[model samples]
Target: MKIIQKHELNSLKRSVDQGTEEQREAVKKIIHDVKQRGDAAVQSYTKQFDRVDLEELRVSEDEMDAAYESIDGEFIEILQEAEQNIRRFHERQRTNSWFEPAADGSILGQKITAIDAAGIYVPGGTAAYPSSVFMNVIPAQVAGVERIVMTTPPGKDGNVPEGVLVAAKLLGVHEVYKVGGAQAIAALAYGTESLQPVDKITGPGNVFVALAKREVFGDVDIDMIAGPSEIAVLADDSAKANEVAADLLSQAEHDARSSSVLVTTSRELAEKVEEQIETQLKDLPRYEIARASIDDYGAIIICEEMDEAIAVINEIAAEHLEIMTKDPFGDMAKVKHAGAIFLGPYSSEPVGDYFAGPNHVLPTSGTARFSSPLSVDDFTKKSSIISYSEQALKSNGGKISQFARLEGLEAHARAIETRKERWK
Candidate 1:
């Protein structure tokens, strides 16, 4: 990993970044093809990419039953446990519309309403992540979305992963389709013959899926254009190097482009963490990917002091920030930017990702400065309410007419002027 002094680091603008153009164009093509061909085009991509050829593109009730039965009882217990935590956390985010009655007989307030339908995209093929299903589906459920649809690629054997099916069933996702990549996003945005279009689409996928979501945004609402996972540890001499290294590797294994940086004032701690990473990398199953991530995007910066370290942390605006200093809360107050802040050693990033209440699908590639984690708010919208009684309108009519005339809106001014004349 490269080491840099805090002062030598670039500005905050350069800290958070995005992926390559080539990847973006490739994903655009996927979106175009899916939009043009629909389900036939989706099947073609699935065959070419996932190596799965299927007669039907939807997971059946029988399949869900089998998936539930196939999974071990102990794992099911864990899933339920994680589901409870996620549900509890997101339940607090639910909101209701309200109205206020004025003394003058004018009522005003905002109305909150949930979207009619929501689509969730779960990545399939190389891996099965049941946790993602819980994180994405539970929030929509809490938001009171009418229908929840999910799309995921089927394996080469033309079957959805048992774990994924079980998780989806537990969360009450209404439908599951054997679709993936940009095609799945296109199907969600512009509904295919079999699949119904949704009001919003959420969840994480590969580069193609992210770009597809971006392309279809105006047509349908979407969650953030998530890039690779990243974590920044604001550690001090008090933090254990081994524990820090383990936490960093947890996100590193996500993708080759993922970043794992340690911003600390302790040179000794950095060296020890480096050594620990080297030792631990050999034992990890996904060490090759993790190693590439750490070598390519990882950094260890030695700041002048704790405040300098905090500055570096804000610059990166990492997706998952771990403050392992003696005063994690004190440092947290200074952290102006980050998708999620994990204070102290006990609060690892995985806690938020899996069992903890907060959403794990966070903004990546420095987009945290502007983007936000998925929540009930993503599935609901608020409309401003306004009402003016006849008396109130009469009182402001002259002023309104004058304002409209100043803006060169003759029709607007005439409308107010006519109302005022009637009152007179």
Candidate 2:
């Protein structure tokens, strides 16, 4: 990782809004073809991208059963434990419809309803993420989403990974489809003959998938357009250089564009961490990818004080922030913008990524400045409820009409006036 001064941080901010013209055009064509041709377009794109030709798009029960049999008992047990943690955590986030009644016979409240159906996009190809299945599906389930569908690209053999299938089946998501890429997003946004449309979509994917989500955002609700995974560790003299280096590399291995930054008050520790990263990268299996990411996007910022470090962290608004300082909890109070905060050395980022209860699908590329992690709230909608008695309308209608008239909205003024006249 390159060592840079604090002023250079602005250059490290990943451009979340920019995409190449070729990528946008390709995604647009795929989405258009899918919208026009339906399942045929989806199938063609699936073959083109995944190199798999499938007679069936949906995963059958028999295949699910085979997947269960293929996996061993220990892994299944681990998945069960993760699911319970995820479910328990999200259940706390569930909200109920409420109404507040007033003495003037007015009722005001929010009616919360889960979306009818939700689709989650899971990536396939190099890696298989059963954890993603748990993280993405469980929150929708907690929110009481009626139908949860999942779409993942199949392998060259035209078979979904056994682990992926097993995780989906565990969550009771049987409506698994063997489609991926921009076309799969289009299929989810607009219904096809075989796959039904969903009300909302969630989960992360490649640039094409992210761009596709951006394109179909209005047609269907989607989670934030996630960028490359990133991690920022704020450390002091007390932190172990090796552990900090290891944690930074954990995120760096995610992709060539992933950002791993270390901001610390200790210049001595910073130099040690720089050395440790080089030592550790030699043994890492994904060394090439991690090296490219660290060489290009990674940084070690030496701050003068903890407050300065905290300010730098907030400005970056990293997706994951870890504090290995003596008082991590105390320092965390000063942090305003990270998507997920990992306190102390033991609370490494991976804990939240897999086993811990919090959803792993976090806002990336400085989106943490405004957006948040995917939760039950993403799968639900809120409707405002308003009720007014005759006496209440008579008391307030004249003022409402006057305000409406001030805005030159005659129809709005008349509507209130008509109600007031009836009450009188």
Candidate 3:
């Protein structure tokens, strides 16, 4: 880890990807081909990209059952508990369709309604992410979405990960398809012979997937274009160097581009954590990836005071922040930006990633400054409701007409004025 003074904070901020013209053109071609040939194009791309030939796109109930059976009992038990926690947490986010009526019989309100269906694209080239299934599906289910469709690339052997299937089975999300990359996003946005289109899509994938989401956005809603994982730890002299180093590595091991940062008031603690990061990297299964990430992206900033440390933290606006100070809550009160904050040493970042109820699909890069995490709200839409009685309209019609006319929308003014005929 490169230890630097707080003046070098500019090096920490990275720009969001706009994707290359070649990638954009490639995605456009893929989407257009999927639209023209439907299932045939999807299958062809699946064979070309995933290296698997799929006679069928949808996963059957028997296959899901077999996947459930394949997993051991203890892991299933853990998944069940995590699902319950997630469901319980998200159910609290469920809002009702509310209308407030005035004495004049005018009602103004908001109507909250879930979309008809959602598409979840889980990346399948590397490791199986059962957590993605849990984090994405449970929120949509809680939002009262009628149907949920999932798509992932099939392995060379023509099988999705057993753990992923098991998680979907537990949640009753049976409408899964064997597709990946831009084509899968295209299929979800526009219907095929076997797969129906969804109103919204959520989940993370590769750069091609992110570009595909950007390409298909107007046709269907998408979750954020997630960057690589990152974690920033704010610690005092009291925090254990080894534990903080381990927490940072948890995110670094995810991708070679992942960044792990530490901002601290103690120079001694910073040097100790630097040593611990190197020592622990030797043991990680994905050591090369972690090593590259730590060397290229990771850093530690030495701040003389707590206020300076907090300032650096807000500037970074990390995806995950762990406050390991003696007064974690006190220090956290000053934090203006962070996708998710893990307080105390015991509340590590992974606890929120897999087991805890909060959604793991969070805004990455510096997006936490203005954006939010995946939640029930992302799965639902709201419609404004307005009903004005005769008396109410008579009171406000003139002002409304004038306001419309002020905008130079004469048609709008006339439309509002035409209702006056009944009063005359």
Q: Kindly list the per-residue Cα lDDT of model 2 for residues 280-317, writing each as its tens digit.
A: 99999999999999999999999999999999999999
Q: Stretches of candidate 1 above 4 Å error?
A: 7-33, 421-424
Q: Write the per-residue lDDT of candidate 3 for residues 1-424, one digit (tens) a residue.
A: 9997677767766666667999989999999999999999999999998888889988999899999998999999999999999888999989899999999999999999999999999889779999999999999999999999999889999999999999999999999998999999999999899998999989999888899998899999998898999999999999999999999999999988888999999999999999999999998999999999998889999988999999999999999999999999999999999999999989999999998899999999889999998999999999999998999989988999999999999998888889989978
Candidates in order: C-alpha RMSD to true structure: 2.1, 1.0, 1.1
TM-score of each: 0.94, 0.98, 0.98
* Model 3 spans with C-alpha error above 4 angstroms: none
Candidate 1: residue 203 Cα off by (Å): 1.2
TM-score of structure candidate 3: 0.98
What tens-digit string does per-residue lDDT give for candidate 1 at 1-424? 6676666444212232234798777777777776777788888888888887877888899999999999999999999999999999999998889999887778899999889999999997568989889988999989989899999988878998999999998887749999998889989988877898998999998867877888799999998877778899999999999999999899889888888889998999999999988888888899889989888877789886998888889888899999999999998999988999999989988888889889888887778888888899999999989897887777777789889989999999898677766666
